[model samples]
Target: MTSFLTISLDFELHWGRFDKTRLRDYLEYYQETLQVVPAILEMFEHYGVHATWATVGSLMADNEEEWRAYMPTVLPQYKYERYSAYRWFDAQPQIWEEALFAPHLVRQLIDCPGQELGSHTFAHFYTCENGGSAKAFRADLKAAKTIAKSKFGQELKSLVFPRNQINEAALAISKEEGFDTVRTNPQDWYWKHTVDENLIKRLFRTGDTLVSLGQKTSYQAPQRNGEELLGLPASRLLRPFRKGSLFNQKRISRIKEEMEAAAKSGEVYHLWWHPHNFGHYPKENLRCLEDILQNFSVLKDTYGMESRSMGEF
Candidate 1:
């Protein structure tokens, strides 16, 4: 059996960080995502890397009107309304920034060979937030499917929950909604899926990026026990490469070590990150990605480790 390496991206533009991020502050970073996407695709093709772009469905629309028209009927009523993308979008009907809409970028991903376009959710739905309901999740899934089919002719088969908030109630709905695979967080206790952020978990997770302070960051193959949906748990998050940071080498080395261990043991290694992670340092991030992929090429020849999209499992 070959060791499998999977890459999934949380490809939400403003929708991913709207609650806390002000577009005015990070406009340049957001704009960089559009510029870096083509370069990222170019690198993937060159390195024979296969990835899943688990995107925000609103990104498929050309404008805010089309996006609003596809809003889920049962919207989430989070205690903090700011968490609701629909509420945020409703407040600002006219989108002044192009950073929020990226139909062209989504189209490029769809047209790219060996790339899978999956759903992050219709509006970056928070499945684990307070007052969230199964009805809302199901409705969100339906809206995502509807827009994706209409825009890109894609039947989305993979899902990466917003904020990695895996809602157990929504698993069956995901299968019924035609999703075959879903990315779960790592098995580590600190990596447990949750809407509420924990300070201890954050400290451990942040420290682990530079050193072996937590889980080994490797997992077995995705489990599909007589079910329509397969559990494609992530092994590690590819921390954004920060230029001029002394910790950059250590972080990259840790990731490489985990990848090597997975390759040698024939385990599964799933690496994920957001496209905006590369927004600030596009060139450096691309170089870091190329280095990782180049190492993967070596692992491929030596151990038959294969690069796969999330749906492949």
Candidate 2:
């Protein structure tokens, strides 16, 4: 079998970060993201790369009214009130008109060749949050599919749970809703499903990007649960470009080495990141991406490694 390279992006704007971020602080980053998407599409097209955009369903709306209309009846009820996406919207609904809505961008994504639209859940729903029931998760997914079909005239086939919160019960609902596959966390211990946040795990995750501190994450094949959805476990996160970072070259070198190993060994190497990760330093970020893709081209020549979207893989 030929080695495969897959890229999936979590394309949520303000929706994914409402719990931890204040929009005013990152307004410039969001603004740059609008430019980043088109550039990313151009680069992908030029490199013959196919990617899945796991979009937040709310980003499918043209305005706040459309977004509100598609919201699920029962929202996530996390013990930490500030973690609620709905409550944050309730506090300042008007701000969504500008910050949260991104239907135009989603339209651009659909038009871009080789780009597949997938679900990141409606409203960036948190599946593992304590107070949110399985019923609420299903309701949220139903809203996601409904809006996606109504807006794009296409059924969503892949999902990436918000905050990497994978709920087994929710996977059944995802399959019932018609997803072909779902992106899961890497099989490393640090990336496993957990409600409790740990500083050591967080630090290790960050450090892994710059150096191979843990396991080699490449996979040879996907797994299937009883739900019948293919489990496309992630391999690595393409960390964003940081200014004055001494490890920039080391990070890129680590990614290229991993890709080469996967290609030589005939395994799948999946890389993912958010569009906003490129938002802050568009030029630098694009250059880093180009470097990775350039290495992929070399791998293709030597080993016939192929590029695939999540659904395609």
Residue-level lDDT of model 2, residues 139-161, one tens digit each, is: 88889989989988968998998
Q: Lowest-lDDT window of 10 residues in candidate 1?
A: 88-97
- Superposition-based RMSD of candidate 2 using all C-alpha atoms, in angstroms: 1.6
- Alpha-carbon runs more than 4 Å astray in model 2: 93-96, 223-227
**Alpha-carbon RMSD of each model:** 1.4, 1.6
Evaluate model 1: give its lDDT.
Answer: 0.87
lDDT of 1 at 87: 78
Candidate 1, 71-182: lDDT as tens digits = 8888889998999887787687455558788999999988888899999998888888887788888999999999999878999999999989886687888988888999
Per-model CA lDDT versus the true structure: 0.87, 0.87
Q: Taking the candidates one at a time, how many backbone clashes does each contain? A: 0, 0
Each candidate's TM vs. the true structure?
0.96, 0.96
